[model samples]
Each structure stands twice: as C-alpha cells, then as structure tokens.
Target: MQLALSTLGCPDWDLERILSVGRDAGYDGVDFRGYRDEIDVTRHPLFTDRADETRSRLESAGLSISALSSSITLCETDDRAAHVAEARRLVEVGDTFDVDRIRVFGGGDPEDRSRAELARAGGETMREILSIDGAENFQWVLEMHDAWTASDDCQQLLDELPADNVGVLWDAAHTIRLADETPRETLDALGDRIEYVHLKDAVYEPDHNDATDDGYVYAVPGEGDLPMADVVAALRERGYDGWLVFEHEKRWHPSIADPDVALPAFVEWFRDQR
Candidate 1:
C-alpha cells in the first residue's frame, strides 16, 4: 500500500509546504481536503486558476494526488443541486490533477430515517452526479462517516447504486468504533468496493470525556486500539494495493496533535509496518 496524508491534518500549511513536507516525510501522495484557510480546493486559486502550476509543483515534489476529499454529503435533504454540482466540479478538478478518486460523505442520522432510506438518498444523488459527462471516469468514493459508519449501512448505499464507479472509502476507525466491527469483518464485507482507505486511530471513552461527542479521541497511528495492523494485514491478504491515507482531523479539532508532530510520526509508523 502507498502512503498519503490528508491536508485536513495541516489546514494552516500552504501548498508548497504541504508538498515539500509530504515529500520529505516519504509520503507517496496527498489526499487534498484543503489548503491553508480554503476549505474547498476547487475554488482555491492553486487548484482553479493555478491548476497546472499546482500539478507541476506536486510532480516536482515527487507526490501524486491520491484523492480529492470533498465535503459533498449525499444523504442530506438540503441543497441537492449544490451537492451534485460540487461533486461534478470536484471531478473536473480531479481530471486536472490526474486524480481518479474523489471522496464524498454518506452523511445522515439513522435515527431520523432507516438505513435503506439513507442509502436510497445517497444512491439517487450519486446517480445524478454520475450523469455528468466524464464523471463516470472518476470513482466517487463514499466515506464511512456520520451514520454510515456501519458496514451494513454502507452496503445498503452501495446496493442502491448500480454504477461501478461508485466505491467505498473505508475509514477503519469509524467502522470499528461506531459499528463495532473488527477489521477483518469490515474488509470481508466491504472489501470488493473499497477503493481507498482512511487510516486513523482512536479509543472509545464512554463518559464523553474526549474531543468527540461520542467520546472517541484521536490517537496517532498504532497508539490506540484501532486494529490498524490487522486492517493492513487483511488488505494485503486480499491483494489490495491502494492508498493508505492518514486522516489527521486537526482542522476540525484544534486540540489534537499538530501536523508537525503527527505527520512524520505516521510516516515512521507506516514504514515500520512495512
């Protein structure tokens, strides 16, 4: 598996710093979530106006863009057109970066609707997004996030979508923490459609004592009980050679370790695993 780090980890870093540090840290690629204060890469000047320069810079740094992690939520009832347009725009940006995968979120509350309903919503939105010309060439990856952390729920969403380009972005932490699935079980169930993996670690604290409302606190790779090693072993056993993205959520949670401390640490830990 190749290693990549999400720009979500270092939201304050500019594009040059991101590529330079990532290259030096032995990262094979970067999962572009944001750069500096810009939350949307497609709108950012580096990607929109200076796209060619950005690509050249990335190439010069010896790094590829593994994926463009967008905030397009499919299961939401609000602004469906905006969601589809955003996804289409991201696909356009993906083309510019030679990126084949675009990360999206399966966001909704299970308590508000059945998993099937959520899946249907996600499927419909995905179908609409895929209808755009050239959109089918890119994999619109649905991340295991929000209420779709459960493999079965994610499977339900996949079942509703018939397009082969739609795939899963397996976030190991969520499936384990929220759905109570072991690494092997998650891979066994969603292995076929998983196109990318988000590597994060955290421990469950039932008393809501952590940064997360659900009591899950972020930990550097291998420091928490996330079964990351087992997950990697399962992927290898399945002959999966995809991007293993280290998703450090420092942007949303400022209390977490800075990227300066967390980024190289992940590279060392990942290399040790090899």
Candidate 2:
C-alpha cells in the first residue's frame, strides 16, 4: 500500500508547508481534508481560482492529491440541493487535480432514524450526486463513520449504490472501535467495494476522556490498540494496493501530537511493516 498524509493532520499549515512536510516525510501523496482554516477546501482559493498553481506545487513536491475529502454527507434528508451543489464543486476541484476519488461520509444519527431509513436516503442522495455531469469521472467512497461504522450497515447502503464507481473508504479503526469487528471480518464483508482507506490508530478508553467521547483516543499508528498490523496484513492478503491515508485528527484534537512528529512516525512504522 502507498502512504499518504491527510491535511486533517496539520490544519494550521499552508499549502507550501503541507507539501513540504509530506515530501520530507516520504509520503507518496496528500489527502485534502481541508487547508488551514478552511474545512471545505473546495471553497479555498488554492483549490478554486488557483487550482492549477496548486497542482503544479503538488507535482513539484513529488506528491499526488490522492483524494479530496469532502464534508458531503450521504444520509441527510434535508438540504438536498445544497448537497448536490457541494458535490458538483468537489468534482470541479477534483477534475483540476486529476484526482479520481472523493471521500464522503455516511453521516446521520441512527437513534434519530433507523439504519434502513438512513441507508435509503444516503443511497438516493448519492445517486443524485452521481447523476451530475462529470461525476462519473471519479469514484465516490463512503467512509465508515457516524451511523455507518459496522460493515453490515455499510453493506446495506453499498448494495443500493453502483458497484463500479461507488464504494467504501474502509476505516478499519472505526470498525474495530465502534462495531467490535476484526479487520478480517470487515475485509470479508466489504471486499472489493473498499476503494480507499483511512489509516489511524486508537486506544479504547471505556471511560470518558479528553480525546474523544467515543472511548477511542487517537494514537500514533503503532502506539495504540487498533489492530493496525492485522489491518495491513488483511489488506495485503486481499491484494489491496491502495492509498493508506494516515488520518491523524490533530485538526479536531489540538492536544494530540503535532503532524511534524506523528506523520513521519507513521511512515516509519508502516514502512517497517512492509
């Protein structure tokens, strides 16, 4: 698997710093979750008006824009038009960089609506987004997050979407931490539908903690309890040669290790495994 760094790891850095850090750390690419203060990076000038310049910078840094991580939630029933617009904008940004994958979230509270209802809504929403002109140029990968942490739950939603261009962005940590699933079980269920991955490690703390309310504190890849080794082995066994984006959530959790430290640590650890 190729290694990449998520800008979500270093929210304070500008594009130049992001490219520099990623290059020096030996990453093959950078996943754009956001840039600096812009959570929706498509709105940022670097991705909008100056996208070509940004692409040139990436090329010079010897890194590719692996994927554009959008905040487009697939399950929300309200603001359908807004969601479609956001997806369209993302497509434009992605096209400029020649990146063919966009990350989306299965975001809805399951307690408010049943998994079946959310899955139906998400599928419908994704279909509309895919119908947009030029949407077919990219593969939309729904992340295993929020209400869709379980492999079976994701499969129910994936069943409604197109198998060829729509797939799962397998976040192994979520399956293990939230759904109590092993890496092998998640791989078996999702299989080839997993088009990309979000690599992170976490320690499960049953009690409330500073890192998260969900009992999982983000850790540097090898320093946590997330069965990351098993995840890698499972992916290798399946012949999954895809981007493993180190999703260090330093943007949200300021107390965590800085990207400068955590990013290289992940590269070293993952390379050692290989």
Candidate 3:
C-alpha cells in the first residue's frame, strides 16, 4: 500500500505548494479538492475542462491524483441535477488526469418513505452514472458518510444496483459517527464492495454542535483514543491495500491544527505500525 496526504491538510496553500510539500515530505499522492476559495476555478485549469493541464502539474510535482475530493452526493432534496452536472465535470477532469477514483456519496434518505420507490430511483441513478461514457476510466467509490452509512442503506444501494464502478470508501471517523455496527461488521457487510479508504483521528467533542461535536473533530492520527491501529490491522486483514486519506478539516477547524505539521508524525506512526 502507498501513503498519501490530502490537500485538506494545507487548505491555505495553493495546489502547487501542496504538491511540492507532499513530494518533499515523501508522500505518494494527494486527494484533489476544487474548493472555490482554496483553488479558484476561474484561474486554475485543474477545475476547468483542462485535464491534461492538471495531470501535467501533478506529474511535474511527482504526485498522483489518488482521488478527487468531490462533492457529489446523490442526496439533497434539491439540486440533484446540479450535483450530477458537477459530477460530470469532475469526471471529465478525472479522465484527463487519469485519476484512479472519484469520491462520491450515495443517495440520501428522504424521510424513509416508499422503500420500493427509493430503491428504484437509486438503481436508475446508479445505472445512468455507471453507463456514462468514460466513467469507467475512473472508479466511483462512495464514501460511507452522512446518515446513509447505515448497513441497510449501504447494502441496499449495493444490492439494488451493483455496478462495476460502484464501490465504498471506508472512512473510519464517518462510520464511527453514522453506524451502530463496528468497522469489522460494516466491512464484512460491504464485503467486496469496498474500494477506497480514508484515515483520520478525532475526539468526540461536545463543545460544538457539529457532527464532530459528538465524535472526533479532526484530531491528529493516533492522538485521539481511537483504535486506529486496530482499524488498520482490520483493513490489512481484509487485504485492503490502498490509499489512507488523511483529512484535517482546515475548512471548519481552521485554527485547530494543520496537516503539514501533523504529517511527519503520522508517517512515523505508519512506519512504526509496519
């Protein structure tokens, strides 16, 4: 498996600077995010229809686009079409960059009504997305996030329509917040559907009203009292040899901490584990 850093660590830095930092720090790749303020789409071709340009920058930086930190969730009662459009744009960029995967979250829960209808609608959407030309160029892995992470929700989405491109991103923090099942239980349920993984540590802080208030709010890896080593061992036991995305929510926890400072420690932690 390879170690990578999310651009999320250096939210204040430009993508170029983050690229250089990751290379210098000996990270393998970066999780690409297209936040408007962080990386202006108007000025940067990485957000535009210029895949070659984005790929060239990363290649020059000695980094790979491990996954696109996309905001595509088929949920939200409104703006579903807009979300799909956004996803299409990202897919074009991913194809150009030859990115391995594009991160996504599956459909939302619309008040637990009409189970049949929800299933049908979800299947249709997945089919349309999977059938999209060139979507196969990059795998679409749905991070088990939001409230849709319950075993039934995940199983239903995978069961209703098992597309070749459909896979799960095993995010420990998100799963810890959203599921009653242990990581082992959830992964066993997901079985072969898991394709990507995100690694981070945070403590359940009730000081705030956000989700992190109830759980780890972007704490440094191994700092919080999470069984992260066990989680890693679990993934390894399952033969999950892939990227472990480190996410420091610099957007929300701007003053909390930064990834650049926490990364060297994380690399050491990883090395020690190995």
Candidate 4:
C-alpha cells in the first residue's frame, strides 16, 4: 500500500509547502481540498490550465495527488442540492490532477439531529450522490465516519446503489466507535465495495475526552489505544489492497500536536508494520 498524508492537517498552508512537507515526510501522495482555502489550488490558473506542469512539479519533488478530500457529506437536508453541485465541481478538480478518489464524510451536520434522524437523512444523501452520472473518472467512496456508520445502514445503501463506483472509505476509528459493532462487522458489510481506508489512531475514551471528530480521539498510528495492529491484520487477512492514508484532522482538533511531531511518528509506525 502506498502511504499518503491528508493535507487537511495543514489547512493554512499552500500547495508548494504542503507538497514539500509531505514529500519530505516520506509520503508517496498528498490529498487536498482544492475547493477550500487549504491549499487553494482551485484559485490558481495552472490548476485548471496547466495540468502537465502541475503534475511535473509534484513528480519532480517526489509526490502525487492522492485525492481531493472531504468535499462531500450526506447529513444535511438544506444543503443536499448544493452538495451535489459542489461534488461535480470538485470531481472536475480531481480530474485535473488525475486523482480518482474523493474523501467524503458521514455527517452533513449530525450535531443538529437525533440518532434516528441522522441515519435516515444520511442514507438519503448518500443515495443521491451515488446517482450522479459517471463523468469524472473518480468514484464516490463514502467514508464511514461518526455519523451514518451502522453496518446495516451501510449495507442497505450498497444494495440500493446502481454503479460499482459507489463504495466505502472505511475509517478504523468509526468501526471501533460503533456502540454495537466491531471492525470485522463493518468490513464484512462492505465486501467488494471497500474502496479505500483512512488509517489513523486514537485514545479509547467514550465521549472522547480528546476525540474531536468523535468516533474516537485522533493520534499517530501506534501512539494511542486504537487496535492498529489488529486492524492491519484484519485488512491483510481479508485481502484489502487499496491505499491506506494517514488522515490527521488537526484542522478540526489539536490532535496532531504539530506536523513536525506527528509526521515522523506516522512514518515510523507505517514503516515498521508487520
């Protein structure tokens, strides 16, 4: 598996700096949110016009664009239409970089709903996203997050979708956070639809004493209580071959501490994997 870093960690940095930092830190690829201020490549003319130059720059510096993250969410009613529009635009951006995957979230805004409402709405949002025509070569990999995470619900979704492009980006934290399930259960439901994974680690605190995204607290791979070793073994045993990205949402929480601090630990842990 080619290891990569989510540039969502340094939301304030530009593309040049983000690419350099990730390359220097032993990352094979870097995922970005080009639509946002974080690495705002969308604003650059070159991002749209000079594709070869951009790819050349990154390749020369030892990096590739993994995916343009996290622009999709399936939890809000009012923003659902706008969500579809934004997804099309971001997918175009991904096409520009030849990146074929887009990171997505389970919660549109689940903080505003009860558990039942969130599940119902989140599933609906996912269905709409899956119905989009396949123009962009990338696929809609619905990342399992704190919201919309039940194995039954996810299976129900896959049963309804039409194309093989609709799949899962299983985050280890979300599987562990489910009060009634295990990682094995979630992965089993995914089956052939497991497209990629958001590799991370965290402390096992129930209301998440430090968890910012709330499935669990974020930390380096082996730094916290998350069953990183077991999770790895399970994926390997199950024959998962997709990319395993280190997703540090320091932009949302102080989880990473510092890039200088966190990146090295991540590289070390990933390299030493059995």
Candidate 5:
C-alpha cells in the first residue's frame, strides 16, 4: 500500500509547508482534510480561486492528492441542501486535482434512531449528492467514525447506497478503540468495500485522558498500544493496495507529536512492516 500524509496532522502549516514536509518525509501523496485553519479546504483560496496554481505545485512536488475529506455528513437530516452544495463544490475542487476519492462522515446518533433509519437518511442524501453531473465519477467514501465506527454499522449504511460509487473509509483506530473489533473482524465485515483507510495509533487510557473522551490517547504510530501491525497484515492478506493515510490528530489534540515528527515516524514504522 502507498503511504500518504493527511493535512489533519498539521493544521498550523501553510500549503507550501504541507507539500514540502510531506515530500521530504517520503510520503507518496497528501490527503487534504483541511488547509491550515480552514477545515473546508474548498473555501480556501488554493482550492477555489487559485486552484490551478495549487495543482501545479502538487505536480512540481511529485505529490498526488490521495483524497479530499469534506465535512459532508451523510446521515444528518437537517441542512440537506447545504450538504449537497458542499459536495458539488468538493467535486469541482477534486476535478482540478484529478482526485477520485472524497471522504465523508456518517454523523448521527444511533441512540436517537435505529441504524436502519440512519442508513436510509444517509442513503437518500447520498443519492441526491450523486445526482450532480460529475459527482458520480468519484467514489464517495463514508468514514467509519462517530456513530458508524463498527463495520456492521457502516455496512448497514453502505447497503442503502448504490454499490457502484459508495464505499467505506476504514478508520483502523476507531474500529478497535470504539467497536472493540479486531482488524480481521473489520476486514471480514467490510471486505473489498473498504476503498480508503485512515491509520492512527493510540493507547487506552480509561481515566484522566485529556486528548479524547473515548478513553484513548493518540500516540506515534508504532509507539502506541493499537494493533497496527495486525491491521497492515490483514490488509496485505486481502490484497488491498490503497492509501494508508497517517491520520495524526494534531489538529484536534495539540499535545500529540508535531507533523514533522509524527509523519516521518509513521513512514519509517510502516516501511519496517514491509
């Protein structure tokens, strides 16, 4: 699998720094979760008015855009038009970079509604988004997060959408930390439908954890207690050759290692696995 760096790791860095650091760190590409302080990169000038310049910079650096992550929540019933409009804009930005994968979130509370109900809502919204002229050309990957961390739960939502363009962005850490699932179990459940991946490591801290309310503290890829090696092994066995994005949550958790430190550490660790 190819390794990529997510912009989520360095919210403080400018676009130039992001590209330079990622290329210097030996990453194959960069995944745009945001640009500096702008969580919606499409709204950022690089992706909007100066899109061609940004594309030229990426090509000059020999760095591909692995994916574009958006704040498009599929399951939310409110602000349907806003979500669809955002998706359209994301498609426009993605086209400029020839990026085919766009990350989305399945954001909703299962306690408020059953998984089936949530799936239906998310599916309807996705259908509307896909109806956009060029939207069908991209793979809309629903990230395994929030209420959709478990493979089975994500599958329920995936089943609601068209199989042709919809798939899962398997967040390896979440399946283990939140759903208590093994890598093998998650792969078995999602199978080939996992079109993209977000990899991070963490140690369980049941109490006094300031980084997260989920009882886990983010760690550098290999230094943590997460079953990362097993995750790689399972994906290899499945012949999955996709981007393994180092999703360092530096943006959310300032106490974690900086992108300059954590990003290269992941490349070194993952290379050791090979």
Candidate 6:
C-alpha cells in the first residue's frame, strides 16, 4: 500500500509547506483535512481561487492528494440540506485535486438512540449525496467513527444503501479501541466496502492518570497496541492496493508530537514493514 499523511497533523502548515514537507518526508500523498488552522478547505483560498496552483504544485512535486477528509456527518436527521451542500462543496474541491475518496462520519450519538435507527438515517443521507450528478466519479466514504465504529453497525448502513460508490473508511484506531474489535473481525465484515484506511495507534488506559475521556491516548504508529502488521497483511491478502493514511490528529490533540516528528516517523515505520 502507498503511504499518505493528513494535513490535520500539521495544522499550522500552509499549502506550500504541506507539499514540500510531504515530499521530503517520503509520503506518496497528502490527505487534505485542514491547513493553517482552517478546517474548511472549501473556504481556504488555496482550494478556492488557487485550486489550479494547488494541483500544479502537487503534480510538480510528484505527489498526490489521496483524499479530502470532510467533517460531513450523515447520521443526523436535522440539517439535511446543509449536509448535502457541504458534501457538494467537498466534492468540487476533491475533483480539483483528483481525489476520489471523501471522508465523512456517521454522527450517531448512541447515547440518544439505537445504532440501527442511526444507520437507517445515515443510509438515506448517503444515498441523497451519491445521487447527485457527477458524484459517481467519487466515492463517499463513511468512516468507522462515532456510533458507527462497530463493524456490524457499518454493515447495516451498507445494507441499507447498496450503491457501488458508497464505501467504508476503515479507521484502525476506532475499531480496535472503541468497538473492541480485532482487525481480522472488522475486515471480515466490512473489507469489501473499505475504500480507504486511516492508520493511527493508541494505548488503552482506562485507569491511567493521564488519559483522554475515551480511556486512551494517541501514540505514534508503531509505538502502540494497534495491530498494524495484521491490518496491513490482511489488506495484502485481499489484494487491496489503496493508501494507508497516517491520521495523526495533532490538529485536535495539541499535546501530541508535531507533524515534523510524526510524519517522518510514519514513513520510516511503513517502509520497515515493506
């Protein structure tokens, strides 16, 4: 699999720095989640008015825009129009950069309702977005996040909307940490629909003095408990040849290591596996 780094890790870096550092760090592509503290790339001038320049710069550097990680959530029943508009804007930006996979979330708060109910709503919402003209060229990837971390719940949504372009964005950290699923179990249920993968690691610390409310904290790729080797091997066994994106979420967790340290470390670790 090819290696990519998300701009979410380098929240302070501009477009120029993203391209330069990504190429220098030996990343094959960059996932555009945010840049220079701006989470909405559609509003960022680099993707709006300077989109051509952005594309040319990446091409010149021999790198690719792997995917555009959007904050769009489909599980919420309210604000349907707003969500669809946001997805369209992301689709436009992604098309400009030749990115085929756009990451969205199933924002089902399980505390409020059942996973099945949320999946039904999310499936309808995903279908609406996929029905748009020209949307067939892109895959709307619903990540294993929030209430959808459970592989079976993800399968429910997939069953509801049987579309070729609809797929899953496998987040290894969430499946293992939140859903208590082994990599093998997750792949067995959703591997056929996994269009992209988010690679992150964390140590479970339910009783640790310093732990996130989720009872875990992000760790560098190889330094934590995630089954990275097994996940990669499973993908290979399935003939999956997509990008393994290092989703170092320093943008949200400021205490984590900077992209300068995290980015190169991922490259080295991924290369070692090869």
> Best lDDT goes to which candidate?
5
Per residue, candidate 2 scores C-alpha lDDT tens digits across 50-154 of 888988999999999899999888888796788899999999998889997999888887899988888888889988998999998899998988788898888
- Model 5, C-alpha of 197: deviation from truth (Å): 0.7
Best by TM-score: 5
Q: Give stretches of model 4 more than 4 Å off.
A: 34-36, 39-46, 49-53, 106-136, 204-210, 213-216
Candidate 6: give the clashing pairs. Answer: none
**Arrange candidates by lDDT, highest first: which order?**
5, 2, 1, 6, 3, 4
TM-score per prediction, in order, is 0.95, 0.96, 0.87, 0.81, 0.97, 0.94
User: Candidate 5 on 1-274: residue-level lDDT in tens?
Assistant: 9889998899999989988988888999999998887899989999889999999999988899999999999999897899999999999999988998999898878899998998999999999999998999999988999988888778888889889999889999999988999999999989789999999998877574455877788888898899999999999999999989999998888888888899989999998997
Model 1: CA > 4 A from native: 204-210
- The lDDT of model 3 is 0.69
State the weakest 10-residue window (summed lDDT) of model 3: 34-43
Q: Which run of 10 residues does model 2 get worst, by summed lDDT?
A: 204-213
Tens-place lDDT digits, model 3, residues 155-260: 6666666567677887776676657566788778885887777777776776644436464566767787566787778888899888887766666667656667
Q: Candidate 6's residue-wise lDDT over 1-274, tens digit each?
A: 8889998789988778888888998989999887785887888898989999888999998899888888888888887788899888887887788788888888867788787888788878888988777777898888998777889877877777646888899998888878988888888888888989998877776676545678876777788777887788888888889989999988877877778888899888887776
Assess each prediction's global lDDT (C-alpha) against the native: 0.86, 0.88, 0.69, 0.68, 0.90, 0.84
Return the clash pairs for model 5, or none: none
Q: For residues 1-274, what per-residue lDDT tens digits would candidate 4 score against the true structure?
A: 7777876566666667777877787888877654235345554565667767877888888887777775556666688897777666666667767787876665644467665676567667766765566533577777776555776666554554434566788777666766355667766777578878777777755585556544467776687877777667778789887777877777777644566667667878877777
Report the Cα lDDT for residue 246, model 4.
79
Model 1: lDDT equals 0.86
Using TM-score as the measure, name the better of candidate 1 and candidate 6.
Answer: 1
Q: In model 1, state the lDDT of residue 197.
A: 97
- As a whole number from 0 to 100, the lDDT of residue 262 in candidate 5 is 93
- The local lDDT score (0 to 100) that residue 157 gets in candidate 4 is 45
